[model samples]
Target chain A: MGDYALEVTNLTKKFSDFTLDDISFKLPKGYIMGFVGRNGAGKTTTINLITSLYHKDAGEVRIDGNRAEDDKVLYKESIGYIGDESYFHEAFKIKDIVSIQKDFYPTFREAQYMQYIEQWELPTDKKIGEFSKGMKVKLMFAGVLARDTRILLLDEATSGLDPITRDEVLVMLQKYIEDGERSVLFSTHILEDLEKIADYVFFIEKGGEVFCDYKDQIMEAYRMVKGGTDELTSELEKEIIGLQKSSVGFQGIVSREVGDTIGDKFLVEQPAINDIIVAFQKNMGGNHTWVQ
Target chain B: MKIVISNHSELPIYAQVKEQIKEQIMTGVILEGTKLPSIRQLAKDLKISVITITRAYSELESEGYIATMQGKGSVVLGRDNDLLREQYLRRIEEALETAIETARFLKLSNEELIDMLGNLIDDE
Candidate 1:
C-alpha cells in the first residue's frame, strides 16, 4: 500500500465551459481531508474522476498506489463512494441491495452489514423509495462501512440532513478511521461540518486549487482585521485581501505576518473557515500559493 | 475529563485541547498517573480527526504533561505547580501589556487606569 490512501496529481478535466485545472492533493492514511468549494466549483467533477466514473482529460488518479487507469477493478474496490443522491434502484429493498452488494464486492461482509442495519434501526423489508432522506443516508453509510474499503470518497453526503443526524454521521466517520488504516475525502460546502472532523482542507475555487494544507496551519496563516475607515492606509490596503468597506467601518483579511506588522492599529482576530473561504474567493485574482 | 471546544474561539482546536487538558491536570481534577484516553479513542469520542488528537497529545508530551508508553496509552505526569504558576503569570503580563498600550492610545492617565483596575477587582 502507498503512504497515501488517495493521491491525485495534476488531475485535469475539461468541460465545454468549465475546466478542472491541475488539481492535486493527498489524503494520507488515517486522516480526513475536507474538499471544500462553492457550488459548481468542479468538486463533483474531481470526485467523479477519482472514482473513474468520468474519464480524465489528463493527469493521474491513484488509490493505494494503483492508478485509476492501470488497475480499474482494484482501484474501484479500494474506494467506497457516497454521493449526494442515492445510486441504488428505488424499487430495491434493503435486503435486495445487500445481496447485490455481497455479490459485487469480494470483501463485502454480511454480518457487518447486518450489524450496521441493526445499529441504524433500518427496516430490511422496506423499499429504498419508502425511506426518508436521512434514513437513506444512514443505509448508504451502513453499506459503505460493511465493506473492507480502505478509502471513502463522500460528495455532499451531509448537505440536507438535520444537525443531529449530521453529527451522528461525523461520529461514525471518526469511529471508522480509529484503526489508523482507513482514510476519507469528503467534499462539501458546509464549513461547520468540516471544522469538527477535518485534519487537512483542500479548497477549490473557480475550477482551480487555491489552498491545501492542514486545518491548523490554515487557521494560523490568516487573520481577520477590523478597523475604522480612518485606520485604512494605502500600505495596509496593499497588504489586506478582500477588503470591504461600509458606512461605519472596514474589514479584511491579511497574512499573519502583515497583521503583526500592523500591531494594535487594527483589531486582528482569528478567521473561521467560512470567513477565510469568503475572503479568498473575493481575492481570486491574486496568486494562489499552496500552503503545506 | 470534561473538555469544551469552541469553533468561534481564536485558539486552534489542538491548542484548545492542550489548554483544557493542562488546566484539568493543574487543578488536580486529573491526578498524576491518571491514564488518559488513547489518541484514537479520544478522537472518536470527540468526533474529531485523530491527527488533531495526536497533535495535542504530542504537545502535551513535549511539555512534560503526559508520557506515552510503548504498547500502552498515555498517562498524566506530575507537574511543578510553581512552574505552571509562572507560566500563567507571564500570560497575564502579556495581556496587561496590550491593555496598557490600548489605554495609552485612548489617552487614559496612569491614575485613571489604576482606579479602573481597582474598580474591576472590587466588583469581582
Candidate 2:
C-alpha cells in the first residue's frame, strides 16, 4: 500500500487499430495531475482503464491503495469517473437523475448537489435532452462532486465548457482537494488551464508515455529556440527536438541542458505546455531525453 | 497580502509567487509573526496549482522569510534574522545601483543624484 490516491502501474491495453503502451504514473493525495496528449494518444484509454470501463490487458490501477480486483464495491465507491458522456437518460430532469444516482453513491450529499446546481444554474425543470453540451458537462461535474469520491477521473470533461465555466470547474477541483485527502486526474487538450492548475502533467504520444513529472519540472525541461535561417547550423539542428524550418526562420524545442551549445544569437524562450506537446510530434525521431 | 501574478511575465509562476511574498515580507506589508494563508487556500485564491504554492512557501522558508509549523500553516519570520537583513541590504543596493545608472544616463552630477534621493525619501 502506497501513499498515492491513484496509482497506474504499467497499464497496458490493446485494441484493433491501436495499443496503449506500458503507462505508469502515481498521483499522490492532495494534488491534480493533467493527463494530456494528442487526439489519438491513448489519454482516454488510460483513463478508461483507471475507471475500469475498459479492462486493461496488463497493469494495475490502485485507488487509494486498493486494486479493483481486491474489493469491487470499495474500489468503485472510492473513485468517480466523469467523461464527456452524459450518463443520463434523454427524458430525465435534474431531480430524476439525482434520485437514481442517490441509489448508487451511498456517500452522496444532496445539499452539495443542490449547491452546484444553484451555482451553475443547471435547470432542474428541463429534460436532460434539452441541455446544451456545455450545460451537460457542467451537470456531470455537479453530479460527480456530489458523490464524495476520493479520486476523480475526468476524461475530456472540460472540452465543451466555456472559459468562465471551465475556470469555475478548475476552482471546484481545487476545492475538492483542499482537505488533502482527495486527488484528481484530469485529461484534456486545454493545456492553458492545466498550466494554471495542474500539479503534475502526464503527456503521452502515439499510445506511449512521453513524460510524466511535476508541471514545473516538465516546463523546466524544454525551451523554445527561434533563430534565423542563416543561424541554423548542423549542430544546432541536431539539438532541436522537433525542428521546423521556413524561408525566413526556424523554431523548435530544445533541452535546457542544450543551452550552452546554442549560441547567444539564437532566441531561447520558455515553451508552454501546448508548445511542448505540439513540437514533440514534429520530432524526426532520435531525441529521447524527455523520458522520466 | 495582495499578490498580482502576470501571466505575461518572463518569470515562472512559482518564482513570481515567491518574489511577491518576499517583497511583502521585506516591505513590512505582512508583519512578522502573522500567519500566512494555507498553501491550499492560497492556491485556490490565486487560481494556481498547489505545487506552485508549495514551491513558493518552501523557497520562502529556506530564505528565512517564513516558517511552517505543525498546526500553523506558515508564519512570517522576524526581520532581524541575519539572512533576511542581508537579502534586504542586497536588494537595496541593487535598487540604488539602478537609480545611479539612470542618473548617469541623464548625465546628473553625484550631488544632484544624492539631492534627488533625499527628495524621494522625504516624499516617502
Candidate 3:
C-alpha cells in the first residue's frame, strides 16, 4: 500500500551506556539502503528494534504498512533477517532446518529452497555445526531467498565472506530486488560494497544518525578539502565539518558551497562514503586519529 | 559495451557509468541503434542497484546518447559530432585547468609550460 517497504520514525532505544537517539529513515520499495556505522554504533540495536527482538523505547517501525509491534507475525514474515551469527541448533542438518522454516513461514517455497541449495552447492545432510563460516552464511542466504519476503534486513552478512563470494552475494541482492516490489536494508562496515550496490545510504555514529540521503547526492554535497597549513584561515576552519590538522597541512570535509567559497586556496576532491564516515567519527572525538 | 566501476575513484558510480557509455558511443564501439541491456539486466551483471543503472541510463537518454522505447529497451542513438567535440573540449579544459594551476603553483613561466606541453605531445 505504502511506497516505502520499511519505515522507521523517531525510533529510540536506551542502554546503560549508549542510546539510539531518534533514528529515522525510509527504505523505498525496490531499492537498497546501506546502513553504515562504526562498531558498537547501534546498527545492531536498530536492526533488533526493527525485527521486534528488542522492544523500542520510543517511536515506530512499519514494514509494508504493518506496524512491526502490533502485527508481530506479519512483520516477521515480511522481513528476511540475516545477522552476523547463525542461530540454528548445532546438531540440526540443513534439510531439517528448511522443513522447520517452512512450518513457520507459510510463503516458504520448498522448490525454491532446493533450487538455491543446489545452486549454492550446500550439503543438505551436513550438520549445521560442521559447515564453515562461509558455508553457514550461504545457508542463511539460501533460506531467505526461498521465502516470498518483501524486505531483507542484513546485518553484516557479508563480512565473513571472501571477496568473490561477497560479489556473488551482492549480485544476488540486486537480482532479488529486480521485481520492483522488494527492498533491502543492508548494514555493514564495508563501504566499498555499499558504493557498488546501494542506491541510498543511512549513516549512523555512536547511536545517533549522521545523515540519510541518496548516494549520488551525498557524493555531490560533501568534498574533501586539503591545503597547506598556512592557507588554513580561521574563516576556512569555521566552514569545515571534520577538520584534521598536521604540521604540513590540514585536511577536512566541507560542503560544496563552502568549498566554492574557498576557491583554489585548497585542493578539493570528491569524498567517498568511507571518507565521510571517518571524518564524522573523528569529528565526534572518536579514538581514530587522521593518519596523513 | 563493458563498463568497469571503481569504488575507490572520486567519481560516483552513476557518473562513471555515464562517462564510460558516452566514451564507447563517441568512439563507435557502441554502434547506432544498438540495444543496450535493460536496467535490471545491467544492474544484475554489474552487481549494482537498479536505481543507479536507471539514473545513468536516464542521464544518457537526456544527453541524446541513448533513446528509450515503449516496451523495448534503450537503444544507442546516432553520434552527434558537435556534442562529441564539446565533450572532448570539456575534458581537455578540465585537464588544462589542473595543469595551469599546478604550473602556476610551481612558478613556471608561460613559455616553459608551453614547451613542456609541446614536448609531451611530441613524445606521445
Task: Name the top lDDT candidate.
Answer: 2
- Ten contiguous residues with the weakest lDDT in model 3 chain A: A283-292
Give a tens-digit lDDT track for model 3, residues A39-122: 999999999999999988999999888896577788888989998877788899987987798799998888988888888888
Which residue pairs in candidate 1 collide?
none
Q: How much does candidate 1 score in TM-score?
A: 0.85
For A130-205, candidate 2 gives per-residue lDDT tens digits of 9998888888888888887889889998888789888888988999999888999999999999999999998888
Give the fraction of reference interface contacts each candidate recovers. 0.93, 0.75, 0.79
Q: List where candidate 1 sits over 4 angstroms from the true fold.
A: A287-292, B79-124
Cα-based TM-score, every candidate: 0.85, 0.90, 0.80
Clashing pairs in 2: none
Error of 2 at A233 (Å): 1.4
**lDDT by residue (tens digit), candidate 2, B44-115:** 999999999999999999988998998679999999988788888888999999999999999999999999
- Say which prediction, candidate 1 or candidate 3, comes out ahead on DockQ: 1
Clashes of each: 0, 0, 0
For residue A281, what is the lDDT in candidate 3?
Answer: 74
- DockQ, all models: 0.58, 0.68, 0.49
- Which prediction has the highest DockQ against the true structure? 2
Please give, as one word, the docking class of candidate 2.
medium
